[model samples]
Target chain A: MTTTAHNPAVESHGHEHGHAEHHGPRGILNWLTSTDHKVIGLSYTITSVLMLVIGGALAEVIRGQLANPNGHLVTMAQYNELFTMHGSIMIYLFAGPFAFGALANIIVPIQIGAPDMAFPRLNALSYWLYLSGAITMLLGFFVTGGAANFGWVGYAPLSDAVYAPGAGADLWIGGLLLTGFSAIFTGVNICATVFYLRAPGLTLFRMPIFTWNLLVVSILILLAFPILTAGLVMLYADRHLGTHIYSVAGGGVPVLWQHIFWFWGHPEVYILALPFFGMVTEIIPVFSRKPVFGYKGMVFATLTIAALSLGVWAHHMFTTGVVLLPFFSIMSLLIAVPTGIKLFNWIGSMWRGQIWFSTAMLFAIGFVVTFLIGGLTGIYLASPPLDFFTHDTYFVVAHFHSVVMALVLGGMAGLYYWGPKITGYMLNERIGKVQFWLAFIGTQVFTIPQYIVGLNGMPRRMAVYPNDPEWQTLNTWSSVGAIMIGISTLLFVVNIVASWKKHPAGDNPWDGHTLEWFTTSPPPHHNFFRLPQIRSERPTWDHNHPEAKALAHGKEDH
Target chain B: MRIESKILLWLGIFFGLMCAVYWTWSLENAGGVMMFFAMGLCFLPGLYYFWWSRRMGYRPEDDPNATQETGAGYIDAFPGSSIFPFTLGSGAFFVVLSMVFGSWLLIPGLGLVIWAALGGIAEGRRGGDK
Candidate 1:
């Protein structure tokens, strides 16, 4: 092995001494107080997974109630709280944080060839703030009024003090404010690290797709989250201080809340999805044994998607009648082009390539197929005429579920793909594959019928429906599917535990293409023993194939 | 930056054209205003990156096998345990609780918040000397 005498910044921090000493901090106190990105990342992942279980439990309750017509699983009020908390917990607490907070914190530094985030202390702060927010949100359940019952959107007038006079909604507002601050902090950390950190020879274009996606996610967070934060403050004032931010009688239009909320809400959808898309982009190419096809196009398309995302907020408000429908509709349609380009590029990468059917690849393929369905259905909803019919219906539910499920599946794929790198233990492949199939099939079974019933004029957030046989039948099937999803999630936990001690994954478990793979499995505290010579976008590939420049240029295809 | 600028420049033009079309369709609506603003925002970043990249050419990040000197010798420094994060979290908790409970908690909550913020800045400066 050649050791290049490089700058002092590239020097390892006495890595040969051993892992324990150099990694810094130990015991329970260290976890609570440490600024190590890896520790913070693990903390974030654990918290998000716990929240996933809590949120998923809420979903089970919802499915149980909807299983039978006029079901008395709980009263209407409890039903409202359950569903509201379900959406809020899953979106705010689980998906967004899991993707950007956990995955990004763990992977971005290693992928970018940096030791840690730019502001490690701020990174720690972000995690603690997030945990605080999660606690506060859950605290709403113990309060007198129950958890926020105006749905997760907490649309105004309904959420007003007159209508919802209690500490529950106030708690919801407080929780979200903290979480928004956490997100903004994390966003700043990510942007700064990517801008300032990066190993030599890793240019903006040469960076891995996942890091690129995170960069865009950071920008979107910085720009979009403050709007939500401001809106929350205003709502809090309206409720507690008797101000009239959203009260129509007080000259404040209730619709103003929709404008502010969806401005953050729509981009919030992308904040969750882009990281998943980036993960899939990275996973597909590596398993297929090819460099990502059209790497530049992938980067360009991601940025374009992000830019267009800012302009499409009104698409969510089309049925509100206040939004200019044509503008939003056109922007929504245009946003699809970049997304379509990504799908094409993914297929192009897998084209004629030695595609592996690993658990990760299976989920990635599932994401592509599922997200395509989601995106296409979204096109129908983007049109004002069509949206008027389906808005707040199960069709819309099915559509967004498809989208969110794709994101969740993508996150799972990333976890499996990077499990070895993060934990030094390969997840049990057979069990992983089983979990993947169950989840995929279960999600489809659960959500597909939502579209059918929705088109049949079933509204969303409804506690009960008329005793119609067809609706009952569809709802029962959906509940069964939901059960399958629950069982699949349990299998995933079992796989993690069962494989915890088995199959010690070596450094390059999948012969990965990026810098992170060049290091030890569950990489050392300093990330690298000595950094590899980067020659192109595929640094590890270049290091391994020094004599095969032609292969690097794609002249000799696999 | 170079590649980013080119991509953004073209996207700006594309959105600019879209704005024209939307404007022609609806002259005095929120949609046109949004499209017009998008066009402007897109162009600003596009031009900035282009200008910045031209000024700083052939950087280490742009070339493979380049010496690692640019980003080397900089092991990330980790700070020891500090109380500010916990205190800040406590401040947030009490402040929120004050809203639900009463105005009495507000004084302590805001006081703790200010105390934590000042302590956090000073803590870092003190650590630098050590």
Candidate 2:
């Protein structure tokens, strides 16, 4: 390891002069074959955005069909296809990939000061696998039966070749297996990089909140996604291999699908959730002008949630009459404690501080408020008796939309927060704020009406409903809110286009503390020039204001 | 590294405890075994880190006296560029299509995977192309 005449550390290392020597080739080759994490990450985000558009369009069709009861805008079969693709694309394609695939790839390595992902080529491979999987799934739209209508969960007997009997069902299985494996590979890389490649002095406790979240999330993904893959394989076997794993006529238990799916499904919530929670955690402390209230508590709470999520899958299956009610109900309820701790930590961080309400901060605040609603409503779902009334109702729909606010609002916050850093361009603040408020109001208008209708016994995933006046009014208003959301999302794209390559975001635009802000706005090929002093979690802030007591050097908040 | 290993060790112990509790709570539930695998997942990486940290001793980061410049050196050699990822993905894609298209794809699908593996390995052994 010594520096010699041929030392890469001196002549070739180039850190003494600053930055790694090459930026590599430009244009398509760099994107296609280069193993740079940033390129792959940006590819992930872009693909998710494209999928988001497709998923959103499908939502509009669903709303169009449901705006009035007994509506016939789409064929009944097409309505089924629309909702199924909407859920699958939003969950598997947009939400999960954007959080874990894009955000983790972009931030984790930089946060740890690693040169690149542990498997740089595999990182690139993830993007390709993701793209091909997405295409494979989208290919269903053109097939004869017009995509899988068995629902995103693809429950048993319903999803069998006998019931579905479409190429779409087979395509759905193939696409997910590829994307699922892609995710599992990404998890392995993140785990390896974080465990093995932290910068000197960046100890476990000293790692950034986002990095900590990635570590736990990678573990969650590794542990959870494989079950989904295995389950899908069994489903495929039942479909193509002529097996009876889920077919009742062949002596298969239908509840087995519920067991297998929920085992992977429940943890998938946290797998998608923990990273945005990480992003919000990072954004809150920075804009609040304080160190995080409980860094260690945040870490432990994240770990606790991951552990509890494992045993609580049965909570989703309580209505099936097969789940152990007490054990799962208790475990599911215990998750609230850790989640509550995190909420309080965020609130405490903002107390009495010079809070800057940037668009990112605004989204973070919105995420906090909405995530609370999502979590509290989940209590009813966790109870076996209570769930009997609400399962498969619009109450569940409202709950889901609220829960994904983390992915929606929290994701928007991360985009505003990190988007500048990634692109080296500042998004228009005025436009961003306007989009934020519209989306905020639209989300409330959208979900609250559903809660009312659901309690009135309006079932979910229904294309046409009986014409009832109250249900009609609520349903129409919900469609209005969906359109508002649609417009606000379009405005976000306008902001991106308007801001691109215009106003250059100088390094440390937010005056942040993490290792990411220590480098350039977009950073370099190697991600660092000269390493900043890594004394504590707030490295950049420490380097800038050496004597600052607030988020100062060497001050660990126990 | 020391703290990370300890944290993961505790998490491993925690998940292991849950596995035992869930198993004792319900003998026929298969989800208990999932918890067992979760424990093993944590311990495998956690213990590997623990052993390696002990073998290599504390990095300069863990040493309080280490200065900013102490970590200034060559990072690992990042692969400049590689086409095998695309090749490997294509290979895997064809294999996935085998699910829809029948078993005939087993030949070329697996063949490309093997080809990419050999190419990637040879490139790594030869220190990769310039």
Candidate 3:
């Protein structure tokens, strides 16, 4: 079914077709000094996967400790360190890096039909900064007092020199600052790439949903992260440089820290979310056998969501009592409209089309359900009166899990969908289907009881709770659910591991629509030898089935 | 029309509109000012791209009638093999290390950083064959 113009069988040898620089040094040396986007992307991917393992192990320990009311598997202090490192690692290391650094690096240039990233060396530097920052953060566990335990938010006085009197706190600040810079640089590179380098017919509007979302997320990172950098610098000053920006004893407002942190932190939620949304959007269309229902609407919704995210930061500060209630509440609720628009487009894409329930498609569906649950709970928390009660409760815990589960589910879809393209092998879908069900059931099992105990007045971040039968029973069930999720994750790892030496997924395994599918399974040093004529977003789809080539040119909404 | 500018222009207006709405509704809070700042952040890049589009004119992709061949041939030079990123990363390692063990660590940290910076510039200017 391959097109005569862009045949994968012939052009698969394009690496040797005059691009002599493609045949560079082998193995480790190639990786070290190399500026290849694929190499850098794999660096980001492998590192984030390892960080996920570290964070997951910490979570299993946390679940074990909370299995019984009196279960003190680790001391209270060490427990703080566990959750703290876990939160930091997942956000900064696992989720953000995987979504932004790894996926963006590996896929963006290919989708846009570019030779490489705009600033290839700067792209390499971004990965290096991330690596150094990751090492710095992990190095904290071995230090005198273990990593920053003032919560991942690092809420002021708790993070001050008095309470967390350790070098770990300083290291945490330093590490985040480096990672922050890394994110900013990556953001710049993506923006520049989109602005400058598009293949002939790849106009801004013609670009894929994935590229649009990365562009918006990059802008968000550019604006949102520097605020964190400034706030962290001030906090560091209060700790070592003798300034009192957050110290109430020294007349510095403690609430100011909340304001600054959430300003960065709330947008950080959308930063984590929008890319995965893009991933689901990409997958839904492929499996459903249709173009996206509304391309312009998705792009506008993304822009609207990003703009609104900047103003709704104070929704997180409702419990602090100093925030503007109506302003933030209305803004936070308004954001739901744009997100709802995205949901409508996804459902419409699958509505009457030939929907296939592949492993990736199942995960995308799971993401929709989980994201809805998380978004609704977030809506409830936006109201100041309700948030006052549920601020630090297990309900919030459940809500956070739902949100992060959406990330996990969406990320799995991306991995399954793109893994063949990254490594030239097909992932076993039978194993994948089993893994998906396990994750789907396990997350709900873990999250549902958390909502129950939370609504029943159990506060979160608790090392140990009082010995009550209701709390004890629910805790045991939740731990059982957590173990199930761990097993599910382990199965995924095995599936990917087994995939290493199995059947070769030839180019266009899915008979896909994008430019990436036109190239070989794991494309050459330069991304594409030839791009299909981009009359519509689904160019490759048009080329493969010329009978429907005219039909593939979608009547996109103006 | 450079379509990149159109994309950013709309995004900038979205941010600016939100800033106006938020400011009018809640000027009493400090968040209004922050919204204004956010608007500026969007506009800076958006307007710069707009200006660039005006100056440099349409990209090959901007034309509906353009062929794929028009976009071919050396777009720009990308770095081939370079040792500077490793040097820069090592320099950053020591700089972060300085945060843990007194300020004495900046000696090696800043030194290596400076060395990498100068070396990268020289490598770029030399145009290969070091």
Candidate 4:
């Protein structure tokens, strides 16, 4: 509640000098060898953004090829590799690590009042493993057969040794295996930190929403990632050891790959999604000037969603006809209930509250609107009949793009929201708004036509389409949208560089409600100088409004 | 804890009944049954917390004005510079690379992994290093 500009505690501490004196290892060596959580988090974030640029360039290639029917932009094999590496890079290298590795590492321990992770060495190992994995995966581009072209899921028989027959596929499996290990290490660290490192007065129900979400994410990573790792191990065996796990000619069932992959795959969506949900949960309340509405409902909803996520894996396998139709259908539909509850809670938090339309808030609201469309279409695809028609089509492509757009936009919101704290400078708001609008509009413009083409019986993952004039027009519009997205990303870079030292953002730029805001902007080596007395979930709120009402005992239970 | 457990207990009962209905209609309804079971298991944490809280009485987290000592203290000791992370990363890369190149690379890969893992664990015990 105490403003950063006026806080005597911040002035007295002189954290920058004190921090450097205590925490040794200066310069680039510090970055490579340091065990500090903040340094590791920044490294993860920087790497992810760079990966995003690489993935986006591949996307531009895909769009350029699709601009015209029977276009000669790329061969069929090149197209396959482009899409495969694009999805793989974005999911494995960017979104997942950006959320869990970068944001959670920096934010969770601070929120819980822990100075560093439970296992700092393991944390550093996780980052190094991730980087090594990314390099190995990208190494495929320079190889003989190019990158693995079996799509991101790497569905079997197609991904088998007979079909793939190269070191590229091997590299894909090995890269993912290493990243899987990285995720497992980070997941263990997060779970241990949450359980053991919480501050005084920070109980289970009283923890911040972002911390709660990360806890569930850690659990999901711990339980779900090993399945993919095991599956990938089998895939490697089939490719190199001449095993018959997925090869149909060798008396193996290819659909078994689908089952194993989607089991991990479905939960993987939530791995990327839940953190954004947490970001929006944090952003909405701060901008709305309200405590999160229906706090217990939000928690229960998040838990239920994670549980249901495990059961709904077969929804992706619905069109394969090997899965149980009614069973997967019912479970998938049921997931909508908990997800809808979260949407309602977000709106309820904003209802009749004083609203500020900061760029971060705009993106959070954008996430809500965008993700709703994705969730609804997901339900539509949950139906066995609809899925059978739209299977492997542009509709499915549009659906996932919408969902991923939500995650990416929400992540941007968090980046901007926490920019002041992370960098000690406020981002230029005018440029930020321009970037957000371009991204929002461009995403809609790009994906809406894909749905139209999908309904008109166009398949996905094709280098060239039939020479229909209508298809060309739609593809052209979509390509324009892709260019817009690219420009918007450039604007983000401009904003970062443009505002590097223009404005010094003091500690609590947004009057934030969480514990991280209580510390200085770009917090010291040890995060907090003196801790606030935490009573409830909103410790800063309690600090600010001491006499608003007698502290409501177990109000979070409501 | 008591309040949340009681709420989830009833919610679990409600979902359990729904699972029964779905199970009766289709005996092959594994997804519905499993989903409901998972939902029911979500209540276990709340139940455990409720029992733990009742037995232990109030902790520092439950009281607003608890003293600083009641809180979990400052961070435990952090490790200084070590080559374990780099060595472990190198070991993993080579192991993966061996899958492509040949079995000969596996020897050094496995050795580095073993050395790094052992060294990382031992590095923590050297007192006053950091």
TM-score of each: 0.92, 0.95, 0.95, 0.90
Q: Give all candidates' CA lDDT scores.
A: 0.83, 0.84, 0.83, 0.81
TM-score-better candidate, 1 vs 2: 2
Q: What shift in Å separates residue A405 of candidate 2 from its native position after superposition?
A: 2.6
TM-score of 1: 0.92
Across all candidates, the chain A TM-score values are 0.96, 0.96, 0.96, 0.95
Which stretches in model 2 have alpha-carbon errors above 4 Å? A1-19, A549-558, B103-108
Q: Measured with DockQ on alpha carbons, how good is candidate 1?
A: 0.35
Tens digit of per-residue lDDT, candidate 1, span A160-230: 89888878888888889888999999998998788667788787877899999998888778767887898
lDDT of predicted model 4:
0.81
**Distance (Å) between predicted and true CA of A444, model 2?**
0.8
State each candidate's clash count: 6, 2, 0, 1
Answer with 2 or 3, whichever has the higher lDDT: 2
Model 3: lDDT equals 0.83
- When sorted by DockQ, best at the front, the candidate numbers are 2, 3, 1, 4
**What interface-residue Cα RMSD does candidate 1 give after superposition?**
6.5
Q: Which should have the higher TM-score, number 2 or number 4?
A: 2
Give the per-residue lDDT digits (tens) of candidate 3, residues A137-180: 88899999888898888998899999999988888888898888
Between prediction 1 and prediction 2, which has the larger lDDT?
A: 2
Q: What fraction of the native alpha-carbon contacts across the interface, defined at 8 angstroms, is recovered by model 3?
A: 0.44
All models, RMSD in angstroms = 3.7, 2.8, 3.6, 4.9
Best-first order by lDDT: 2, 3, 1, 4
Which stretches of model 1 miss by more than 4 angstroms?
A: A1-23, A550-558, B1-59, B75-83, B126-130
Superposed by TM-score, candidate 3 places the C-alpha of residue B19 at a distance from the truth, in angstroms, of: 3.6
